[model samples]
Target: MGMIGKYARLTPGELQQILGDPALGHRLVEAMGEDEEDGRRLDVDKAWHAMSFFLDRLGFPVEVVFGEQEVAGAPDWGYGPPRYLPPAQVRVAAEGLARIDGATLTGAASRQELFEAGIYPDSIWTRDEDALAYVWAHYDSLVAFMTTAALAGDAVVTWIS
Candidate 1:
């Protein structure tokens, strides 16, 4: 599988527990797999890097796309251990994401820009409109995911798989 990005909303207590025992992070990843349609989880597919570039171009901190805290000892599903954003940071990220209108998201980065930035999974970015559409759709999903996590006062755990 390619480097798909996954996000799961976690309760504050859940975050604390995971921090104390990083292996618990695996359970969250498994739970995400069990029910992808579950509101608590989001799979951004292969559009992660392009989404990151666009969001960064829109002025949101890169951490909002990746994460802040690394969960030491968490299983490396693919890229690395899961990283997370606390509830406070989630709220801030949600605010920034919410401010991004569709037009801005679509126009922030051109295909050439994405290619030049050396975004991951390079082959996909060569497809012109399809590539942009893929990234836009996933970015929209991400905005909704962060917004919901913030409203629920939950932290967000992100991992690449």
Candidate 2:
């Protein structure tokens, strides 16, 4: 409900057209991108930050490729201040994220790791069983988006609503 985001893998030129004509941008977003509409109601930025925390815990440094601020204009997608990661960069981050073991991402250990990072409140984090479910939901959702982008040689992109 607060600052939600959807992602799409798009070519630079196709993206250019979307940003160039605001009238058709919203339509394009629906058709061209994947929406995390069914997942837990977590802010995209917070989820991304948590992912960053997870990466750091493993002694790996990767770029936060989502919800960034870039100097670009949106066409039909509405206002400006959108950011996008090129296909090459998306592929790189996708690889890093994909490196996380499936079990590690959904297991108790990963939940504890995130809790230790102070990303969630102590009260809620104490409920590891519940917390882990939500955590895994977001993790899987992100992986799906990033992996899709990487496979299609498309950029990872988002715009402010």
Candidate 3:
């Protein structure tokens, strides 16, 4: 057993069970270095890799949720105002959101700016709907990746949104 594997731990019957797909299971198994008696081998890097894998399988959506004009096009989902915006809570909420593999913007702005040449939010924690507009304007690839990890068996993304 490798040192990492020995130190790592697993709580599920099999990594495949959590991933909900056989192909993902195969990938995780291959990613693992070796078996360990402690069985505690979960880590962020592995989870991130899995998220990227699943996003690749899902295929990111072409639409941007925040676009109000004809140029931005439609998306699979819509964005709206959140109930509240607190301090130090900007990182995840301000970044972006993706149900599967697309981006969404919920505030006053359209979804076009996130990927547009000069489109990015001044900050995520801003209470101004206009300032928060960027979150809706662009599809969050990172969120899509993280969501996949959270959906995976026994895995959770506690940090950021």
Candidate 4:
């Protein structure tokens, strides 16, 4: 199986509950599996690496891509424990992401540039043209996800699984 980037929107109450007991983070993410209809969840698939690299190169803060708050004791199935951003931070991230025009993101870097920059899943960078297209599509989805979370004043949890 491949690593997938996942995000879950948390209401203030849910955020508090998880913060008060870090273990709740695991339960929350696991429960998300059973509720696939929830609009609060997003899966960016394997595009996370290229997206993060592009966002970082574009001057967006790391918090927007990887989050700032680490949920201590949360299980790390692969990459690491789930990380979170508070509602205020989510709004900030959403604003930053909104400023990234499609033309700019798509034209900012070539596959070789990205590969040399050390974007993850290194093999994809030299494989085919579809790699960048795949990253761009997932990035659009991520922007939409963050925008909705920000509008709802919801916290966001992100992890690799």
Which residue ranges in model 1 land beyond 4 Å of their true spot? Answer: 106-108
Candidate 3 per-residue C-alpha lDDT over 1-161 given as tens digits, one digit per residue, 9 for 90 to 100: 11110112122444224234433432343365444222323223212222322333344331111111121121211122111111112123323333332322232233243224232222223334443323222234334433333343222211111
Top lDDT model: 1
Tens-place lDDT digits, model 4, residues 33-85: 83536668888888888877767667777465577988776777468888999
Q: Is candidate 1 or candidate 3 better by lDDT?
A: 1
True-vs-predicted CA distance for residue 64, candidate 1, Å: 2.1
Ranking by lDDT: 1, 4, 2, 3
Runs off by more than 4 Å, candidate 3: 1-104, 110-139
Each prediction's TM-score versus the true structure: 0.90, 0.61, 0.21, 0.90
Mark the 10 consecutive residues where model 1 has the least summed lDDT. Answer: 28-37
Estimate, for each residue in 20-133, the C-alpha lDDT of model 1 and write its tens digit.
999977875576674757788888888888777777776676486679988877888678888999999999999988888656876856777777879987877677568887
* Model 2, global lDDT: 0.56
lDDT of 4: 0.82
**Per-model RMSD to reference:** 1.7, 5.3, 17.7, 1.8
Question: Could you give candidate 2's per-residue lDDT for residues 70-107 as a string of tens digits?
Answer: 52544524335456677777788778778776456444
Model 4 residue 31 CA deviation in Å: 1.1
Inter-residue clash pairs, candidate 2: 19-75, 21-76, 22-75, 22-76
